[model samples]
Structures are given as C-alpha cells and as structure tokens.
Target: MTDFDTDVPPDATPHVCEHCGRPFARERYLALHRGLDHAAALSDDERAAYETAHDAETDDLRRFRLLALAGVVALYFGFLLTYAVVT
Candidate 1:
C-alpha cells in the first residue's frame, strides 16, 4: 500500500542483453550486468561502454550518499533545536 511497495510492470524491462538475452529496466543496468557477468565474451567496444556506464553509476551513487547524509544530519540538528526551544 506504500509508495515503496509499488509493483513493477512486466514491460518495464525494455533493454535486453545481447550476450545472455537477460532483460533490464535500464540500458545502464544491462551494460553493467554484461560487464560483470559476460566479461570474457565482451568485445573492446562493449567493455569501453561498460566502463563508461560503471563510472557514471559510481558518481551518481556517491552523490546520492552525500545528499542522504546531509538530509539525515539536517533532521538530527532540526530535532535538537526543536527540543532545546521546547524544553
């Protein structure tokens, strides 16, 4: 019933890996999977593409972690300030 509990549609995965026919919701995910799972079979161009996608994904994850930490810190300070004013 929650927003996080929403189900994914069957057609959500449009990107199919050529190496394994495995489907992924995003092309980047497919690239990553291919890089990790089919490294032995990958050509030079596919490997390069995977490296680009992996770097982008890593940067995005780092940014998300920093933002989440900031949000948590802000909430903690806000709660402390509220308690100080009320008490």
Candidate 2:
C-alpha cells in the first residue's frame, strides 16, 4: 500500500474527491473540499456531475435523517403510551 493508503485506517476506504480528483485519506475531506476548492475546483463537466451527485447525496441524507427522527418520535410515544396504560 502507498503512504496515503497506509495512513488511512484499515476499516476506512480512501476517497478521491469528485470535484478536484484529489485522493483523501479520510471521509471528512468534504469539508476541506468545500473550503478550499468550492469556487474554481472543478471543470465544467465535472462541476455538473459533482453537483448532481452532491444533490443526490444530500437528498438521501435528508430522507434518512427524517426517517430516523420519525422512528425515534414513534418509539418515544409508544413508550409513553405503554407507561400510561401500565400506571
């Protein structure tokens, strides 16, 4: 394995930034991407593709977070209802 790969933990996969094609050892490289290369980062074609992928990922994350929040709320209510019934 290369030095970059070696630096990354065994459980983590190395990611190349879709925008800049820079190999990042960590997943949190998105924050660096946003800060460093957000404006002049990508070629026109790459920019379009990156935007599409970013939007899809954002939408998926929103959907999953909403689902998780709903599950937590339902579980909380379920417990409250059971407690009320038991008491």
Candidate 3:
C-alpha cells in the first residue's frame, strides 16, 4: 500500500500539543508548532504552509456564515410575506 494509506500508523508517536491539541506524528511538529504559534520563529516554508491553510479555513468559514445568513434572511422574509397575505 501507499504511504498515505489511512490504515497504517505513522512511525512516530502521535503527540498532541497541549496548547492547540493538534496531533503530530513526529516530534519535530511540536517544535514547529511552538515556533509558529508562540515564538513567531517559523521558517519560510512553515510560514507559507500555515498561511495557506489559515486562508483556506477562513474562506470556508466565511462562506458558511454567508450561507447561514442568507438562509435566515430568506426565512424571515418568507414569514413576513405570509403574515402580510394572511392579515
């Protein structure tokens, strides 16, 4: 099977950070997370990856919020229309 197979566990211990609860398969990830979150000492590649992931997550949340707002507005407008028709 390929390395990305979900059934296979990674070689390193599954250590999760106390601050973020982010699971890391390698000890190096703890250092990386500490540097990025607490120390602001991320390498260029680490910074780039973090920024990219953050942007994607932010975009997803924004889209979900917008959709939820739209649904609420539509429901409110529908209620108003029904009330107006009935009265």
Candidate 4:
C-alpha cells in the first residue's frame, strides 16, 4: 500500500451532525450540510470562504497523516543511505 494510506485511529468516529445527530462520511460534508440546512443566510463570498476553510479543516487529518507517512519514508531511505556509507 502507498504511504498515504493511513489507517483510521481506533477512537476516531464518523462526523455527526450536532443539530439532528445524523452521521456523515466526512466532516466536510457536514459543513456543507450545516450551511445548506441550518446556517444563517450568507453572502456568496462569505459562503465561498466558509466552504474553503471547512475543506481544509476537515481534510487536515488525512493531509497530516500523509505527511507523516512521507516523513517515515524519508527516514527509512536516509537510514539505508547511511548504512551503505558506513559499510
């Protein structure tokens, strides 16, 4: 598997809507759901900004996890190169 394929943490749970207690597959979906269903009227620009920020917030976990995996891969290669030089 690719380094980006990080496993879900045992304690991690699906995103749930606070208003109605409905579960969503991803947190971003909940943000859109809330905006469309529950939030106050927002201007077009405000809505656009909110959606952008929400995407980053909800996707942060996966993004960081992939970065961590990339870090590990780098470390592994660094170790191998160091070993070769030592030998």
Candidate numbers, best TM-score first, in rank order: 1, 2, 3, 4
lDDT of 4 by residue, 8-84 (tens): 35477866666666666666566676777766865575467568857777699789999999999999999999999
For residues 1-87, what per-residue lDDT tens digits would candidate 3 score against the true structure? 122222225675665656656666655555556556755656676666666656666788899999999999999999999999999
Please say which candidate is ahead in lDDT: 1 or 3.
Answer: 1
**lDDT score of model 4?**
0.70
Compute each candidate's TM-score over C-alphas: 0.80, 0.59, 0.57, 0.37
Estimate every model's Cα lDDT from 0 to 1: 0.82, 0.66, 0.66, 0.70
The TM-score between candidate 1 and the true structure equals 0.80
Task: State the displacement of the C-alpha of residue 39, model 1, in Å, after optimal TM-score superposition.
Answer: 0.9
Candidate with maximal TM-score: 1
Clashing pairs in 4: none
Candidate 2, residues 1-87, lDDT tens digits: the string is 323333656577767666555566754445445444775765676556556666767888999999999999999999999999999
Residue range 1-87, candidate 1, lDDT tens digits: 112222335757467777666666777777898899999999998899899999999999999999999999999999999999999
| lDDT for model 3 | 0.66
Candidate no. 2 TM-score? 0.59
Question: Which parts of model 3 are misplaced by more than 4 Å?
Answer: 1-36
Candidate 2 scores a C-alpha RMSD against the true structure in Å of 5.5
